[model samples]
Target: MSLPQPVPPSWKDLGKSSSDLLGKDYHFHGAALEVKTQTPSNVAFKVAGSRDSKTDHIHADIEAKWTNKAHGLTFTQAWTTSNVLRNQIEVENQVAKGLKLDLATTLSPEKGHKTAIINSVYKQSGFHTRASLDVFKGPTFTADTVLGRDGFLIGAEAAYNVTEGNITRYAAALGYNAPEYAVTVHGLNNLKTFTASYYHRVSRDVEAGAKAVYDSKSTHGGVALEVGTKAQLDSSAFVKAKINNSGVVALGYTQTLRPGVKASFGVALDTQKLNDPSPVGPSHKVGVSFVFDS
Candidate 1:
């Protein structure tokens, strides 16, 4: 007998459909640039910078990654302008066929802070699981699992604070995915918030998605709704637009300038506050990002 196939995705990705449509490339408050290059010896380097329009502050980061395909190992080191250094090492399918391990550490010299985390993932036919533990400070532990068969999936996640000896987080999600569409619902933050999301491929060049979130902790127990759509203008270009319950609209346009180079432009407008007088003047924000790879 043949083995069953693994599930489509893990619990953390249950809302990926709405996330991609409503959040992808829609940077409406800052400008950013990124450049990446790889060497022949399996070393890759990346440099990125972003500028906040309101504060006029520029933030930058540099990262280097090395991968060894033979050993199924990868290492990454990164440093940011905030004086924080980070390192991560990953091993895949080494100790076990369907297991992966990751170790990550962060150090902040200016703040005299250090932290570490370890993560493990195991996957098998129709099931997937992940666990992460913080080896520093409160030493929190989190785990999540997903089970799927016939395009339907159910998952749950929880976190425990070892130092405090209490459960800090808990959530559950279920989803159904098909070639043409996907739908997911999640109860998050110990059931304090509930969200539902849907994605549909309307046509060969168009996709639509929507998300609804209800928060029990809100002053009036309100619900927020957002709907978005994406249209592929061509193989190298696409446009997206979305609007939310608060009369805020966002539009994004992305294009591949050339091989290994891409650029995106985004704008946000608040319809209700368009005529309001303020120091910032207009109730709109614009952002752009460029990426280059070699």
Candidate 2:
């Protein structure tokens, strides 16, 4: 069986900035705006700030990009400041017909700061593939004090086409880091996760699938199994629902508004027990979210 060709890269960028200036007592006392655009890739800037009776802060960023198809090279850099300064740079190359390599580095300048560097290379040929990786020290969280918590996360994923009508995907991941707050008083905490999913199209615009997920931490572990079916309602709308472990269920709906706009909303309800005790009222939350994408 032959797999479908990958989609070509598109030139696009998106970003959002918002601020709240009013205190909690006043409901309509903040300023906010969202901006998006696609133009010649050279440099772009955005600024957002708030100063009133409550608090004051400012944020700004600058980005640059350069892509050359003939040379098979791409470069990108971004710098931002809100409460702290951050800078990142990445370089990628199509080293061969079906091979690619990337090198990237990031630096944060502040009290007790540090930097991180990584190098990765990937090769693709038919259904078989290979990759190499290397990484250096960096901060574990955005708000760091001594940079002593630097660590690394490593993982890989692969997929294969069993035949013209079936495909499978599998992945494994691991990480090392400072003792989690939970185990800081108990001991060091570690985590590992594995997942696999399979899909087969019964007919055009229709499909059925199942997935399995396993997650383990220093303190607890759990497994979930899920299966579902999907069908297109029309050219503008569709719906999907799934049943998982312990009778938990999720439902989702999506609609296309225009040629370049779409929205999605979903809700999930679950009845599962926690492996450990909790101090909070409930172990879960029920809410709705609306998202816009173009």
Winning candidate number (lDDT): 1
Model 2 lDDT per residue over 115-228, tens place: 444434332321223332223331111110111113322333433332332223344332323222100110111225544444445566665556555666525567767766
Locate the minimum summed-lDDT window of 10 residues in model 2: 13-22
Candidate 2 C-alpha RMSD relative to the actual structure: 15.4
The list of candidate 1 runs beyond 4 A from truth reads 1-3, 277-282
TM-score leader = 1
Candidate 1 minimal-lDDT segment of 10 residues: 275-284
Model 1 lDDT tens row, 164-230: 9999999999899888899999999999899999999999999999999999999976789999999
List the pairs of residues colliding in candidate 2.
none
Relative to the true structure, candidate 1 reaches a TM of 0.96
Q: What's model 2's lDDT at 178?
A: 25
